[model samples]
Target: MSLDDRQLLRYSRHILLDEVGIEGQERLCASHALILGAGGLGSPAALYLASAGVGRITLIDDDTVDLTNLQRQIAHTEARVGQRKVESARAAMLQINPEIRIDTLAQRADATRLRELVATADVALDCSDNFATRHALNRACVAHGVPLVSGAALRFAGQVSVFDTRPDAQGERGPCYACLFPEEAPAEEVNCATMGVLAPLVGLVGSLQAVEALKILSQAGNTLRGRLLLIDALDAEFQTVTLQRNPACPVCGHLTAA
Candidate 1:
């Protein structure tokens, strides 16, 4: 799949990078990305991925835009308040890159539906706002052997990481999301509404998620597969820590390395 003249011009900046030259750009232009949310984090993630020329994107969300969401969810406009979130996000993404395909599903995806969706996605982004959905996505990604880029933001704090259990050249794989935060041991669940998130924090984290997803799809740079990136908006600091896969991880432990 070669880039046409227009695509070359559109992705000239990415092609200039040695990491993402012509070959890498083509990979990105052929990849399929599944985004599981259309809220604060999903807004920027969808925007960037569409701008970056990911060929196909499937956005799943059951929520509707509200006046209060304008503070952080950039994909929704005030005029779209009563519209479904997936429709709003699709409109926002198409505005940037109409060449790409954006599939919108305005329904809450269950576990079975997640497995079906994950089966076809090259990579999945966890922008969902709850523990249950996050855990379910992790399980589905693990079962399907798809890479999952997870991001979360609340208040002045945020975190982003890649959970890819696929084996590397050395047959070693990174930890799944369950390895870091197990479902059985649930953390104190929080969201922007209850915790009052910093508006820009989610944008930063979601953009980071887009970066990781692009890397994985393009096979360009080393992804944050085994690293957890922690961001502190109050102090304006960023940190990355190595993550070790838990052998007893409930979601990914049973399967042998691929």
Candidate 2:
């Protein structure tokens, strides 16, 4: 894909980077990203992806924009409080980059829908708030061999990780989400609604998720494929832990064995 004069100027900052020059910018323009949820994490993730000129974005969320969401859900506004989250996010994303395509699905992320979307996506972002949705997306991404960038934030804590299930040239697969957090584990459904999250925590995690997604799509730099990043906003500390694929993982264990 060729960038015209206007596009070149629009993305001049990206093109100026040696790592993300014209070729990388074009790669970004041809990539497709699947994002789950349209809340805090998805807001910044989708915004950066769209602003970076990602060619296509498909966002899924069943909830509507509530007044309470305005605190951290940057994609929604006072005027869109009653609108569906996906619709509101799409509006915000398009407002940033009208040239890119944004698809909105105002529905929950189910296995069937996730499988279909993951198959078409170059990379998937698991920004959903609930464990059910996260595990569902992880399953779909592993099944389709797509890269999954997951992010979560609540209270003053946040976490981000990338699961690149696609095989390398040597047929080596990276650790999946299930390897880190097994699906069979008991549900610990804590969210911002109950815990009262810091407004910037989600933004920080979501923006990092976007950076990893762009790196995967544009082949710019090393991604956090097998590392988990943890953030403590209150203490202003960051930590990274190495991850390994579990041979007994229900999702990607077979790949490791093979």
Give per-model CA RMSD.
1.0, 1.2
Looking at candidate 1, what is the lDDT of residue 229?
92
The runs of at least 3 residues in candidate 2 whose Cα sits more than 4 Å from the true structure, single-residue gaps closed, are 256-258
- Write one digit per residue (lDDT tens) for candidate 2, span 193-229: 8889999899999999999999999898889998999
How much is 240 displaced in model 1, in angstroms?
Answer: 1.5
What TM-score would every model get versus the actual structure? Answer: 0.98, 0.97
For the record, the alpha-carbon RMSD of candidate 2 to the native fold, in angstroms, is 1.2
lDDT of 2 at 140: 93
